[model samples]
Target chain A: MEQPEELIPKKEVLRLTGISYGQLYRWKRLGLIPEAWFIRRSTFTGQETFFPREKILKRIADILRLKDEYPLEELVRLLSPEVVPTEVAHLDPLALAPIGPEGRELLWKSGEYAFSELVALACGAEAIRRGAKPGEARLLVEVVRRAEEALRAPTDLSALLAEKTVEREGLLLRAPLALVGREPLLLDPECRIKVRLDLEKVVEGVKLALGGEGRG
Target chain B: MGERNVTISGAGRIEGGSYGTVKIAGSGRVVGDLVAEEFKAAGSAKVEGNLKAQRFEAAGAFRCEGNLELEEGEAAGSLKVVGRVRAKELKLAGSAQAKGITGGYLRAGGSLSVEENVEVEIFRLMGAFEIGGLLSADRVEVELEGRARAREIGGEKIVVRAGQRSLGGFLSQALGFLFGQGSHKELVAEVIEGDEIELEATQARLVRGGKIKIGPGCRIERVEYTETLEVAPGAVVKEEVKG
Candidate 1:
């Protein structure tokens, strides 16, 4: 549902963030906040700027948290998902528990995996070990696999891991889904255990293991 | 050479080459160059290499890291191209950000940002538009609903005016007003050169044309016209030079 309260005026954002106009504009130029977010509105006084309240606030907080640790350019690279090469052999086996022989084989067969794929594999393996049927685990893996292949940049999987429900043999099963984009996957109701993985955390872990400083 | 359709429904990656038709309903990635007769994506797609397509359509987010060449393209959601884009017809209703765009016809209704030059035969815009470099077109029409900016605009015929509200537009604006979501309407340009030009609600540093009509809500520092120059009551022009 759309709400009027979703937008906040530029004045309000500045007041809340305690930042000046120059800082806001500089950040905008540096690609910290998207130009689309700077909405122009006709007010009684004149034209004013507005932004998506939640998104801007979160971005501002992220920039503040990481500004000291990294430069603006580095922050852009970290915040923005850019596709990069990753080797499957670098993944920690301990973290990929419950990965069935088939899933492991798939990883071993492929020389490299996208970061999103790594997250998906780990989630699917964990789900299978926690009581998901083989088919259900495969579906989970498929979701992440597609995301890894489709996305050109580093993807934020957290948005994709929404809780979903499935019906099988007249029984309703809550299937916690992990996704990267808009891919749809079917899950079997035979999966009984709750599947939960912090994909963001996993991405950070993968990045750190790959010698990149983890996100702030 | 043979007609083929490849659809990726889940997470998938294509090494990138040539295909008859490539469709993505889920997440997809292309690592290298892609040549497709038709390309459609309903989900998100990322291409790390150049993309050449006869027709391209995307309803979800689409990103291309390298150059893009298409006969026709339509985007109803977000699109970002890091390199140059060359198309015959490009229509956008959601939002687009491109490094540069050269097309035969360009129509945008939502938001657009071009980091470099935009050269088109016909350019039409209704919502927010920003160009960091020159915009050259045979014909340009903009019904401003929000802020529009360009470094320079050159065309055979250029028209910039306030948005005209139809029945559906009035209803939407009424709802937006009730919901406190109304947008401003303004156009800003550093320089404008055209054969014939009409401007309203525009702020420009210099305007040079063969025939110029400065309508209401216009502020210009200087104007140079060859044949005729008409200034409406609400317009402000500091200096006028006839050549």
Candidate 2:
């Protein structure tokens, strides 16, 4: 008799990525994320969580382009069920700034990058413009950073979740179903992707097809 | 005291550890402290010291130059401040609205609205909150809206509609993305206005009240509701899901 494919545990996937419990289940239900590959263990902690290389990679790519224009349920339906790998582009520079007196010192030493950009980098100015608190936007920025890193190298998912800075903790890495691949993922208009002015103009020319502004 | 009225002019101060009910009219000044179950300042009242009260109301123009603390006992009152205010916690049932509110902790049963400008190092709310300026907080919940800018954001169901954008709509999208996808429970949303809705990083059963129109600008995380979902042609979605 032939043996079935080895299955990975969900816990392991979460531990490897550091995504939140809520995110994991949300993705699973959306179908953007595949079902958990469970493995029975013999030890006391007799369960394991594993994800397919392709499935997780695809999700990472899709999440990076997350937007707030469409309902989550609808997005799942619109997304293509295909997997393709892509190369990692240049690592963007992330800026952070200190707030309080203690944080001011951190800024003097350049340890603080521009958090404003980080907020803009995550989803866009929609949240902030829509009255989302700075702290809330900052969290989403960090999450986006982690998501990007994971997409670049799914195998080294650990590195994608490393500390964003000395004082900051990279908790966003814990979200489940980290995807990393070259599959063409749709970029939501709500995401605050900082596109160069020249590139933005070009994108605008192309985006006219959909009758929307492409000032990313 | 039933409804006794006390009027004090400029530079004068009133001192009291505890009272039944004190009503201050005109530009009454309090230098010492006031501890009562109910305190109302009609015109402009300034307190240099702490003002502890069970129920506090500032109708027209009220200012708190010092800390204002309230016990959990008094949680069924509207603590409204029109003028400048500096209090710790204005515990009330309705909402806490102030021009300039500076304090440590403020717990409100209803919404927390800060008109003009508000500068607080730490502000926490239990219901929908709206701020005009910078609001630095460790945690937040329900719905939130900042007219100008928001320093940080954290909440389960938050709606912040400012400028041309809608805060409530953004929150609904984020919630849908995080909780609405293929969730065992339904993620329902009712929009009485336009036909545009987006869900990002949320999961739950979704039910829209108006025409379901998804924009190309949307980035959804998941969607797995028990019932079928209907969408208008303009809707653009990109995510994953299962039946």
Global lDDT scores for all candidate models: 0.72, 0.37
| Stretches > 4 Å off in candidate 2 | A1-216, B1-12, B71-148, B159-243
lDDT string for model 1 (B121-157, tens) is 7899877788997677878899876778998787778
Candidate 2 interface RMSD to the true structure: 12.4
Measured against the true structure, the TM-scores of the candidates, in listed sequence, are 0.51, 0.28
> Which residue ranges in model 1 land beyond 4 Å of their true spot?
A1-216, B2-4, B166-180
TM-score of chain A of each: 0.53, 0.29
Which lDDT tens digits does candidate 2 get at residues A2-90? Answer: 23333445444544555443355345434445332222244432222356544454455555354365556544533413111222121
CA shift at A188, candidate 2, in angstroms?
A: 55
lDDT of 2 at B239: 38
